[model samples]
Target: MLYLFGAIALFVIFDSVRGYLKTEDKRKYLVRLFLELTVVIGLLFLFGPLFVLSPLKIGYSTLKEGNITLYYPGGSIDMARDVMEQLKQAAEMNRQFYKANYPMPVVLAQSEFDMLRFGSYPYGGGTGSELSLNIRAGQMTTGKIAHEMSHRNLAMLTGKSMPAPNWFNEGLASYIGKMDEYKKPNELQVDLREGRYVRDILEMRGILGTPKWILKIRQGKGRVLYGQTYLMVKYLFDKYGQEKVYDFVVSLKTNDFEKAFWQSFGMSEEEFFQEFTSYIQNYRGEPS
Candidate 1:
């Protein structure tokens, strides 16, 4: 549409110039040229930014580091480097943990709305086929980006999405991403002892597949739930080791979830929960 407008505007200007040459009418030619320029510039100003940016273009600039490519708006050059290195290190860590060599695109959005505009929210994540992270402005954290990157690693390692409770996915992302970095260990102990940080997986199940649940989680439930899920995943991963963790994730889409987990961990959800309940009650701080 802009191109069509531009072409027509150009024609008007040229015709006006031709008329000026033929008749020497200076004001007529000037008015026509001015109007044409004004309309053309208006069209360019109105739609130029949108046409040049994603979903049409990824960003205003690009930077490459290892297997990661960063797309972000103009800002501090040094900050972009720092952000890239931070996420690259994170992607590398997830790769090492899961034995994944997959690549990912990291998009550092200028704002929450910018993140959404590029199809990257609620915060960050990547699907199997494409490893990527879309982070909102000022939300940079190793755990946050790592959590999303881990999902891509999982998909790359398995070559497909896994079928499992959303909890397991969140747990895996949280655990490997090192969510404990933001946690106040002593405060966690206090929360647990005060019955404020209880891990109520049963209650969590009731909220799934609902819009209200998404809103709640996005608003605040994620903080508590991620902490709870992180601890549970850490316990399981530590017990079974890395390869087994990979086995467990891939198996989710291949077999009965219960059966797959049982085969991988040698326990059912009932038994696992019983043990987890006991462990959390006495939890003090980070494990040595």
Candidate 2:
């Protein structure tokens, strides 16, 4: 589009110059040239950032460190190194817990939205494929790195085309990284007392299907949804154990939720949901 606009502008300018030199009336030609220039400038202003033509002096290097190769991209290299080290530790922890032999590389990018957008692509974060960790200068904490590494581990374990539901996936990631610990039950109780819990998941399920759901959840309304999901996954882990949950997650990699639920724990979805709801309502145990 920019190219076509540029060509048209050039032709208009050349014609206008010819009209100014050879014809009696150059005012109309000048007006046409000005309009063409305006259109060209508008196109450039609108499309310039979209093109990313700034050469993006981004550099990346792969280093084989222990069990994983860290793919580090430009922008705070020191922070990127720290994130990689943290991810390695987390990956090792997950490997020990799951006893899985497969280890894949971790690719750390420079943008959080870029990592999420990459994962948003069709099969972007697949098994034996790369997982992107967006590193911000002051924001890349150990907990955040662990959380992202957990995502990579889950992706590898699932080997599915699309990720599992955000509730399960994000809840588990949040749990692994200890982000859930920040949410005191009292805080949630306050929300519940204030009638802010949004009690029914069905009411907000449509928003869950949209891309903005993450932001919505981060904005606090997502709390009720994630809190419930966290409780549900914690219930599964508590009732069946982490190994069982791991088996269930691995099953989900190849099978649907219903099939995986039954195969992993010998219960149907309806039965599991019933038990899960019961556990959430009655389980008075401390948060894991």
Instruction: Provide the overall lDDT of each model, using Cα atoms, as 2-decimal numbers.
Output: 0.63, 0.55
Per-model TM-score on C-alpha atoms: 0.66, 0.60
Candidate 2 residue-wise lDDT, 1-288, digit = tens: 233345776986687677778866678767876888787655443332121222222355555567666655544567656766776766666665456634655545445454433332222221122233433434445655565566667766776423465556656765666566544454555555577653443223222443554456566666576666566566677678887787778777668765776788788756766665554445455544
The residue-by-residue lDDT of candidate 1 on 1-288, one tens digit each, is 223345776997688668778877688767877887777655443333222233434335677877787766765567788888778778877877777657777666666556544444444443211335666656667766778787667656655444444566667887777777534445555667776564555344322422333565676765556666676778787787878887787675567567888898888977897787677666656654
C-alpha RMSD in Å of predicted model 2 compared with the true structure: 10.9
Please tell me which predicted candidate would have the highest lDDT against the true structure. 1
| Candidate 2: residue 165 Cα off by (Å) | 1.5
* Top-scoring candidate (TM-score): 1
